[model samples]
Target: MVTIALDPTPYHSTHSLLEFPDVAARAGYDALQLTPHPDFGPFFRYPKADDALVRNLKKRAADAGVRIPAILPVQRLAWPDETRRRAAVRNFRRIIELAVQLEVPVINTEFSGRPDELQEDSEAAFYTTMEELLPIIEREGIRVNIDPHPDDFVEDGLDAWRVIRALNSDSIGFVYVASHTFHYGDRATSLIPELGARLGAVYAADTFDHNRSHGLRYITNPPGNAVRVHQHLRIGDGDVDWGELFGTLAASGYFERDDALVVSNVFGEDETADETSRFQLDRIRQLVDEARSAD
Candidate 1:
């Protein structure tokens, strides 16, 4: 049974951290993926969760009949600067501890390196940090999945997978965010199969191909700026091909895995989050069923 979790970012502003499970339940999700939140784990900051808070959160999720399959904490594990890189490593240790306490097996995150800086430097820093963290990840039995986010040191899917593979640890895996399809070289058909079992999670959100219309879909203030733009629009609202994406996933034996995770992470329609979430759930299930049936 593939778990379809909800990313409760749309309710971050309107609801409290403790209310996320209930919010997900109300939106028709039995599982929720915890993202960075001010009260819990803020982005690029040391986690703020304590023992009491972790206990409370676990109980809340249980009460709401929601299972927290994963947590996302965006620490700069690949910072080129020594000071920032060390700080990110420290932050990651705490994040791992939190994951253990919550009994969440997966930590989905980004390769938070500087794209403006030297990619080699960032990659070196990343490996250095991983040297210290991989042992702990293995000891704790937690899977840390990395996404090659837009504007990150390695945004191309194959390149990012290569970086992950270089770590040579089964504890490290890949996160395929659908919204980043274009940035990932739009190679889901090939990428998913290449990733194989190393693909730990899939985030379902639609995004416009910036490469479309001769790269005129979005215009920046300064021409050829370093800005990389993408949207987390509802599925089918943008350019991601659901049939092809899901079909590839099925062909790669993803749907047969017990730990398979597909997250509904549409962040552009917060005004209609409840309705959009329900729609996403149904649509995702429909796509998965259609793909599986065809397979």
Candidate 2:
């Protein structure tokens, strides 16, 4: 069955990481996707998480009866600084080691850098970092999934697909974050088939179309900047076409109903998290069930 994972962003900022598994289990998630935030320990630091903390986190997940399928370290791959990019590569190597210890199969990351920097410089840095980590990734037998993020050097789905193709490794794959639909393309469903088999994981959530002109829909002070804004809302609360998206997901040979990494990421800066997480989880289960029945 497709694994419904709970990302700690829903609670880690306000609550303790130690308490996440139990809440996620109660909410009916089968797996955990650990997200590193500054409020918690320095898990995202270049030195990586200490062994004791990693062991403790694994223990908590086991005790609560959920699996941690992946770990997401907020490392900037496209950073232009030479020294900074080297440090990021070093940290990613350590994260791979930690993943082996924690029995996590995948490590998720983003193509990150100063949005205003030269695109060529950022892309070159990212390629350099990945080339360094290639041997380590192969030896450790871990999968790496990358996503196009808002304001990153590569923010479009097709560009992200090109990066994944250029990597040309079986272990490297693309992640489709539904909340970024508008940022990535005008049509989310259409982009999925284009990525096709290269699409490895999905971060599930709903978001309103940022291009819409309704003044009451959203507000940002001091206008006339290039900033684009969106939120991860529960299903049906936003404008995503869930049915068409799910249908395309099913048609993609890379995505299997029996086993796919689908993370419920309905996180917000000023919203009650647990309730929203539970709501998203239930909605995802229902959708999966419907998809399977149709299949």
Candidate 3:
């Protein structure tokens, strides 16, 4: 019943997002969750001219009744060195600037574990990165939501909390992926309650497959594989626990009408994409309506 923002990358890649943003608006979502892609050529790319185009595009979205609340930058943070780390931080600042202009509140990032950073004092490195990055987040008046994915250094809800606790920064938080928790931990259901407040956004996906995870790319450019832990699909098609999941979101004070759901289960049958996504959205709309009417 919390609000829904559809992650459009699953439905459309980098080049295809401009075209699909309107589709997302028409699909009854108020906001869009942007993804980062790496190899999206030099020009004519989606996020390439995003800075210059954001205002007008936001206006367009306004006309379409969709507002962008967050953009997920998952890849660059996973880079193996300080150089890439700093550059990614700068890029994240840019994303926050766009969010400010678009009136979005958060930019989702990864608590990346790159091969090198992990070998060293990961906890210290993570906080150090945040210490340097916090100024940008605060300057932009935005929170950077960093979640622990299985592929990343910080896995499971508890470790995610440990890192968040270690950093102890107001600007940095966690993105809860139920599938990630389920696949990578002892008891995902147990972790959800403890992680509720830390949960910045709910990344609802079906499977717990860590191999082809889809939400990891921070560039939003094309060609680079999105290190997705799960291939997002319609509600009933995957292994998520809907009853408890919905209950958790409903109870979480952070849940907002502006929250998003990035649909990516458009892989199977062409008909499946349309039919399944539509049905899922409809059901979600009903849930939202029911929640509102209850109030």
Best by TM-score: 1
What TM-score, computed on C-alpha atoms, does each candidate reach? Answer: 0.99, 0.91, 0.76
lDDT of 3 at 134: 80
Q: Which scores better on lDDT, 1 or 3?
A: 1
Candidate 3 has an lDDT of 0.58
| Candidate with the greatest lDDT versus the true structure | 1
* Residues 14-85, model 3: lDDT tens digits: 345455467776666666666654421111122453655666666677777776667766545545566766
Clashes of each: 0, 0, 20
Identify the runs in model 2 with alpha carbons over 4 angstroms from their true place.
38-44, 214-219, 253-258, 269-271
| lDDT against the true structure, each candidate | 0.95, 0.78, 0.58
lDDT for each residue of candidate 2 in 67-123, tens digit (9 for 90 to 100): 998878777677998877877887787788888998888888888765688988999
**Candidate 2 displacement at residue 21 in angstroms:** 1.5
Q: Where is the poorest 10-residue window by lDDT in model 1?
A: 217-226
Q: What would the C-alpha RMSD of candidate 1 be, to one decimal place? A: 0.6
Error of 1 at 223 (Å): 1.6
Ranking by TM-score: 1, 2, 3
Instruction: Give the per-residue Cα lDDT of candidate 2 at 4.
Output: 84
